[model samples]
Target: MQFNPVTFAIPVFVALIVAELLWARRRQPRAYESRDTATSLAIGLGSTVAGGLTAAAVLAMLVWAHSATPLSIGWAWWAWPLCFVLDDLAYYTFHRSAHRVRWFWASHVNHHSSQHYNLSTALRQSWTGFFAASFIFRLPLAFAGFEPGMILACGGFNLIYQFWIHTESIKRMPHWFEAVMNTPSHHRVHHAVNARYLDRNYAGTFIIWDKLFGTFAAEDDADQIRYGIVHQIGSFNPLKVVFHEWLAIARDVWRAPWRHKLSYLWREPGWSHDGSRETSDMIRRRWNAAATDQKD
Candidate 1:
């Protein structure tokens, strides 16, 4: 039997979420809404269902790729650490692409749809992520001779590490930890829809990737972080939240001219055929300009 770390972590995840819920009720009742929490849990259930349905095929592909590859970097003691780092790098690449590319963003947008930042919000995952082929990002590890099981285990640990960061309950961490790891503070900035925070802090387990790639932005105390996507979804219905962006993408691509259809699918979330929509870069520039004007 294959060991599934995420499945084993489910009880721990539930316990922590319950603890957070109790903490929020006592300290910050406004941090969570009943409907939003239910929606998040529903979406999470759907993601697990979708993931299980696709697991066989995904594993098959990885196995085939691993067999075909010439190199066999076996399960040495050091290989585990190496796999963890490489898998995290793969996550950073896929995650950044999910934000930048519309097709992937259609699946990913649901994860960011919740306005409330809580432990439940981490469970609000994408039902269509399997279809989005985001797993392809980690395929290189398999082809490079890393065992698929090791890669998957590292990926699970990466996700488990991220779950705690979704909460607003914990504030900043120690300076050394904050500097090196993806703490709650850094992740809050990532989830913020604020123009300045948009598309920044794309890290998985380590903060070093964001700093090295010029995507790191410190959380600002002056500007409050607003959670959710740029255009918020009004409904708490899981179905609507899961497929809204996909529907929007379909609509945009259907109406777009032939020459621009590919761009509509591949470009950033806010990109449009005309200059009417604003990408994250454009939004940030406008925000910066307005700030400059205010100072002047």
Candidate 2:
């Protein structure tokens, strides 16, 4: 077993969740729904098992890729920060694709299934990420000469950084900090199902990626945020929460015409061959148009 920061942070993660639970009881009772919290924790546990099962193969591939590289970052201290930033960029790419691309979204949707925004929602990780081949997103760093272990460690820290931002408890960070880093405010926008927020704020550690890529949507204090997917999966059952999107994708692929079959797999969620459903772009357009009409 390698030195995974996430594993070491597990105790602290539990402590914070307990602290948040106590806070929620007094400040916002609705923030901690018992069933939702349990489901999220179970899914998170299953994800760890799933990741453990596939870690060896994934690490072997990264090691091979790194060995083949002409350049080697080797164990330089300066390399850690560079690797961490690059890894975060890779995460931003993966996180954005996990929303824009249905195949990836099928694996990532469980994280956003909970309607409540709390520490527990952070634990709703994906059990199918390895199967989704999400590790490919970070393979570029390995090929670019960073050690596989360093890349994985940086990724662990990135995951840890994101866990605390998954709450409604913190409204906003300072303006300067909010501008650069991924805060609870920025993350809340990412989790929001609102028309304006859909497919926005994909940064994992730094918010700069979203700003640079035009995917940034600030958390609007005036407009109440609604969490979860556009089409709600109204079940707290861990199995349903984790696999519903995947099952839907399978059903869609099976039912679609041969010509459009692949589209169902790769297209953004809500995409239908006959235009029966709406993608985020389509939903946003509709919402914008309605807003325009009401103003007129």
* lDDT for each residue of candidate 2 in 1-296, tens digit (9 for 90 to 100): 67789988989999999999999899999998898899989998998898888889889989999988898989999999999999999999999899988999999999999899998788888899988999999899999999999999999999999999999899988999998999999999999999999999999999999999999998888899999889898898899999998899889889988999999888888899999899999999999999999999
Clashing pairs in 2: none
Off by over 4 Å in 2: none
What are the per-model numbers of colliding residue pairs? 0, 0
All models: lDDT?
0.91, 0.92
The TM-scores of all predictions, comma-separated, are: 0.98, 0.99
Please write out the lDDT profile of model 1 over residues 1-296, one tens digit for every residue.
44568888889999998999999999999888999999999998999899888877777778888999998998998999999998999999999999999999998999999999999999988789888888899899999999988888888899999999998888889999999999999999999999999999889999899999999999998999999999889999999999998899889889999999999889998998789999999999999999999999
Task: Judge candidate 1 against the unseen true structure and give its global Cα lDDT, from 0 to 1.
Answer: 0.91
| Residue 192 lDDT, candidate 1, scale 0-100 | 98
